[model samples]
Target: MKLVAKREGLLMMGFKGFTHFILVTDSQEAMMMLKSEMDWRSNVGNFVEDVRLLIIERTVTDVVFQPRSGNGIAHTLAQFGLMEGTHFFWEDVAPPWL
Candidate 1:
C-alpha cells in the first residue's frame, strides 16, 4: 500500500548510511501492489531499472521472495502492524526463537 511505501521512503531518508533495504513478501498481490508503484519507463517493467537507479544513488532497495516459513519475522511484523500500525519506529525486539 501507499502507506508502506511512504514509511519505507521516510525510513530510507532517516537512516544514516544504510546501503540496502530489502522488502520480503509472501503474497503475490502484495508484490504486485509494490511493483506497480516502482518508477520505471513503463508502468510494469519488473522494476530492475528503477532498482538500479537506487543502487546508483548508494541505496540499494529490492523486493525479495521468501517461503512462508523463512519469513516468520516479516509476517510477525505485519501482524504487529495490523494491531499497532501507527508505530513508525521499532526498537530491538528479538523474536522468541532467537
Candidate 2:
C-alpha cells in the first residue's frame, strides 16, 4: 500500500510538472527497496517496479524516515487525503499547515 501511494503521488507530481521529491516513510525497508535495484521475484516487486518507473521520469532527492510515533501531522494529512480524495504537492517551501 505504501509503494502504491508513493507511485500514485509521484505520477500526480509528474503530471503537475514537478521533477524532484523527498520521500518520507515509516518503513525503512520500503525506502531501501525503492533505492536499490528492482527485485523481480519478490512479492512486492511489482509495486516497487511501478514506483521505480516513475522515478526514472522524475527524481527522488531524498528519503526520510518519519516514525509513526512522531508522525501526527502525517497521520492527519493522510486522513484528510482519504476523506477529500485530494493530492497536494508543496515545493520550495513547507506546507502552510506545517
Candidate 3:
C-alpha cells in the first residue's frame, strides 16, 4: 500500500493527474487498497466498465502488471520500500543503489 502511494506520488510529480491508469496485480488486496484512497464517486466504478469507458473517452491508458519475474522494477522498488520502511518517489531514474 505504501509502495503504491509512493508510485502515485512519483507520477503526480510528473503531472498533476494522469489521463488513464491501469493496475494489474496478483493481490486483490493491493487493488482494493489503491481504490480505497481514490475519488470513488468521480473516477472509479466497476473496474472493467471504468477501463472500457476510459478507452472510449480517448484517455491515456497506464497499465500496472504483476508478473513475478516479469515485474522486476516494481517488485524491486516495492521490496526496497518495505525494507527501508520509507516512502520514496522515483522519477526518470530509479535510486542509484537499486
Among the numbered candidates, top lDDT falls to: 2
Against the hidden true structure, what lDDT does model 2 obtain? Answer: 0.78
TM-score, per-candidate, Cα-based: 0.48, 0.70, 0.47
Q: Write the per-residue lDDT of candidate 1 for residues 1-98, one digit (tens) a residue.
A: 42353345435644656555665567565456455545545543334444334444644476555676887766676667567765443556664544
**lDDT score of model 3?**
0.52
What is the per-residue lDDT of model 2 for residues 1-98, given as tens digits with 9 covering 90 to 100? 67877887888888888887787887888888888875767768988888888887888787678797888877676666677787765557766766
Give candidate 1's TM-score: 0.48
How many backbone clashes can be found in candidate 1?
0
Worst 10 residues of 3 by lDDT: 42-51
Ranking 2 against 3 by lDDT, winner? 2
Model 3, residue 11: distance off in Å is 8.6
Off by over 4 Å in 1: 2-16, 29-58, 95-98
Model 3: per-residue Cα lDDT over 1-98, one tens digit each: 53344344434533654454454564555445444535445323344344333433434354354655776776787788779987667657869987
Ranking by lDDT: 2, 1, 3
Query: Please, what is the whole-model Cα lDDT of each candidate in the order they appear?
Result: 0.53, 0.78, 0.52
Instruction: After superposing candidate 3 on the true structure, give the runs of residues whose Cα lies further than 4 Å from its correct spot.
Output: 1-15, 28-65
Number of clashes recorded per candidate: 0, 0, 1
How many angstroms is residue 92 displaced in model 3 relative to the true structure, after the best TM-score fit? Answer: 1.4
RMSD for all candidates, in order, please: 6.0, 3.8, 7.1
- How accurate locally is residue 49 in candidate 2, as Cα lDDT from 0 to 100? 87
